[model samples]
Target: MLEKVYPPFIFNEFDRKNKFGLFMDVEKVIYSGVTKFQRIDIFETKAFGKVFTLDGVPMTCELDEFVYHEMISHVPLFLHENPKKVLVIGGGDGGTVREVLKHPSIEKVIMCELDEEVVEATKKYLPNLSYELNNPKVHLVFEDGSKFIKNFNNEFDVIIIDSTDPTEGGGGALYTESFYQDCFKALTENGVFTAQTEEPFIEKEWMIRAYKRISSVFNVAKLYLGFVPEYTPGTWSWTFASKNIDPIKDFNPEKVRNFDKELKYYNEEMHVASFALPNFVKKMIKDI
Candidate 1:
């Protein structure tokens, strides 16, 4: 009798220019395929359960997914006094939608995902994050987020962009200054917006550019940080921009405490404390 041999799987992410990135050992290859927009893969790792990646960039995993989803969704939602309607661009995995639905004040969420395949894959494999898509309040639409957001005028009260890296898939369109301007025009009065900026270490220059572009369009823009265990440089950033609402002065910590659902990452202290930047980061992006 011949012995059965398991296929070897390795997860690799390399910087296009510098050839510097993460290399992790994979336990199993559960799924892999190429979609119209990008190649998608789902696999198991010893450290991070089932992981989803696009074009070899880790998007989310069973472990530490809450941190990124919570920060990107809640920060902008909580900053607004009453966030009824929200627009979540990209985030086909549905983690952002899960966090957005936590707020009872959210009446409707228009999730504009670029790839329908991403939604199907996550729903089947990453149910913990994608299960919220079944909620009646969520309306999933297949289209370009940058283009779809332009159709509305004074529509959404909160616009949260859960985008993939600009270098991958169809995400580059979402990173442009015009997209931020479109998001600005799509919001109702006193609306707030937030998006996942890059890490301040390896992608410091991109992060600064994002901040400046967003700053140019919105009345107020601020950079904040969060810790994600899986990401390189250990620290991550989110840009919070608003029209006439200040996350620092106007944010009410009591609201976070009063939030009905259980949140793993975001909390009362984090609402204000996250905005307090380290000396190096402040010096890098402050004057802009």
Candidate 2:
């Protein structure tokens, strides 16, 4: 039996092959194989039977990383008239970079990942999702993104932080106020920055706190939602903070369609609609 523990939940026992039992928390399915590294996956049967992966194996349930990655990367990129340079923080899987490079107008993309193992693991096992790493425009940097941004000076037209949940180790700094300040300083006058906030259903308070801190540093702050199953619950939230520029006003569907044809979720109408949060969530973050 395989033994692993996750926060907010616990994995108790594993089947000889691919099943697992949770401690009254949830049920999990495990996939064991070798592409790069050994891995374990957990799924919550009640919540869309969502699957979460660790290391290199497919967990009991599955969540779509694409929907969130596309929305976060394209929203700011499509809004910009011609985004020549972009920065992605913590998306070592290359999913975010893959989407960012879809725009023909983008000349350079710098991805700063804290873990090289994560990059290698994803590249080996999740090849289809990480196909964009081969693009000539992408420059991968394995280091601390916060430190990298501090030295950068007005260099990017768009910045996207496609990171893991804040509770995860090494990812905690991504939610800090100083990180937002550095993001503000790293952008051009009209540049925009966006990040993957947590699930409104579970981490609403922390999400709002992050929004408030970002609001203090950037002139414009916006929160939006998309459904991702791998994360806690099922719904995921993303927050955007900009130095100067109304993200919605800057978008034109016709122009974005010219760049890529693979997008399924983001359109001009959806762009505006996503910002319309439910009254419950609205009330929760209203002050922020």
Candidate 3:
């Protein structure tokens, strides 16, 4: 055991000092190693099933990975008029790629992940989530996405950033204002973008700062709420940004019918409801 360290992604201060933190009881460690980029740990737990963590933070688990993976993939894809090409940055677990492939209209997905090691680990221990990584439409590129997005101009229809904590090794770059500007310029005119911002209950400032960055670059930006059971925070957050499309006004509900039942956490109803923020949450990002 590394002792009960608060995973930094949850927030920098969630420890004995704050007297508040969450812990997942691990029964066994499935795989533990250090990638060149960051530490990787995959553990088995009675409650969360097989879990994956980066550094000391939990990334996803078998029990509830679908909630986040589904929300992140569907909302943006459905929001775009006809999302044929997509770019996913840092979703090495392949969960986001799996959900993106469900839409038949998707012609290609360029997965720009920094660490090939994390992709290999997830594919080996979390096969169900990683199975689609090898699909014909998915291209695996091992590099920094922040740099990769800059090379393209008006290319992808949707861009999803499923990255780790900003404080993790090399992760802070993804949250910067310049990085969002790169993403903003890499998309087609009607493109939609979404990123896993984090849980507002504990990471309100981080969440708002990220939302503000995206809001500055996009013609339209909205903050939506979702829940990841393994994340411990009561409500998780995702930011929806578009070049010219408003997530709600331009939402394509009819497109959801093609893949509705196959999805576990998202549907037409939740698509709209996710954007309806709680009063407290609204107060946090209201100024931005």
Candidate 4:
């Protein structure tokens, strides 16, 4: 049975010093347990509907997930001319895969998640997000993503690293230089790669390190911003690295205009705007 929590559940972030708590009008703990990788909790609140937390940190919620999922999936995808084969690392919730499948150009999507428990819990508690995991075009693989991608060479046209934070219980090796090198090797020529880089306000050093490492491996490295309300400060960033494609210069505006799928957050103008980073972030990654 899942552990139950009452109203006024506190959702902590960074440290106990910075946190966001909500006193829900209605609340129910759908599932809670310690998975092999980390502690998992799925709960429903009046404000966010269904919320998924890992290691006591709120990862994603139903209300504002579209902003994060759309930005992360579409930015690199539309940048690539024909993203037929794609790999998603650590998106067990299936939101990334859901967004990726919206592109008719995508033929196969392999979602390599480290923990199957996260997949199961989300599938039961958050059906809307995890429904795409069963799609014929989607292949679910349970393995350490960093190790899984190393076996491939020039195989995927786009790689999306929807990993957790790189803190103590968060994704450790997934943020390392070695993993970026493996990602570089796994992507084909003209392939584009993007990862969920930490928020600059709270994770400045971590973001800088990721930017530098990705820049060292790929010819074109860029950073883009998204408004994920569930995350701290309401602003989150994604890092893009490409072997040969420049995300902005190589973007297909026609594809965006003619896209058949219904989109909530990302569009052609938003694509161009996402790349326009603040001066502080610009200076941070400028040297790299």
Clashes of each: 0, 3, 0, 0
lDDT of 4 by residue, 37-153 (tens): 888877788887788988766788988999999999999999988889999999999999999999888999999999999999988888889999999999999999989998999
Residue 195 error, candidate 2, Å: 0.5
lDDT of 3 by residue, 1-288 (tens): 234332322222334334666666667878988888777888787777888888656788899999999999999988877789999999999999999998888999999999999999998999999999999999999998888888999888999999886763334889999999999889898888999887788757788889888888888989999877777665788999987888888777877866644888899999999999988888888877
Clashing pairs in 4: none
Q: The CA-based lDDT of model 1 is what?
A: 0.85
State which candidate has the highest lDDT.
4
**Of 1 and 3, the candidate ranking higher by TM-score:** 1
Indicate the TM-score of model 1.
0.93
Worst 10 residues of 4 by lDDT: 1-10
Instruction: List runs of model 3 lying over 4 Å from the truth.
Output: 1-18, 168-171
What tens-digit string does per-residue lDDT give for candidate 1 at 53-167?
8877788888889999999998888888888999999999999999999888889999999999999999988899999998999999999998899899999999988888666
Q: Extract clashing residue pairs from model 3.
A: none
Cα-based lDDT at residue 99, candidate 4? 97
Over the stretch 1-288, how does candidate 2's per-residue lDDT look in tens digits?
A: 235444345443222222532232445443333333334343454543444455422222324666777889888887777789999998877778878887888899999987776677567656656688878898999888878888798999999987755643333788898999999989999788899887576546677877777888899998888766554455778888787777677667787656545876777777778888998889888865
Task: List ranges where model 1 is wrong by over 4 Å.
Answer: 1-13, 168-171
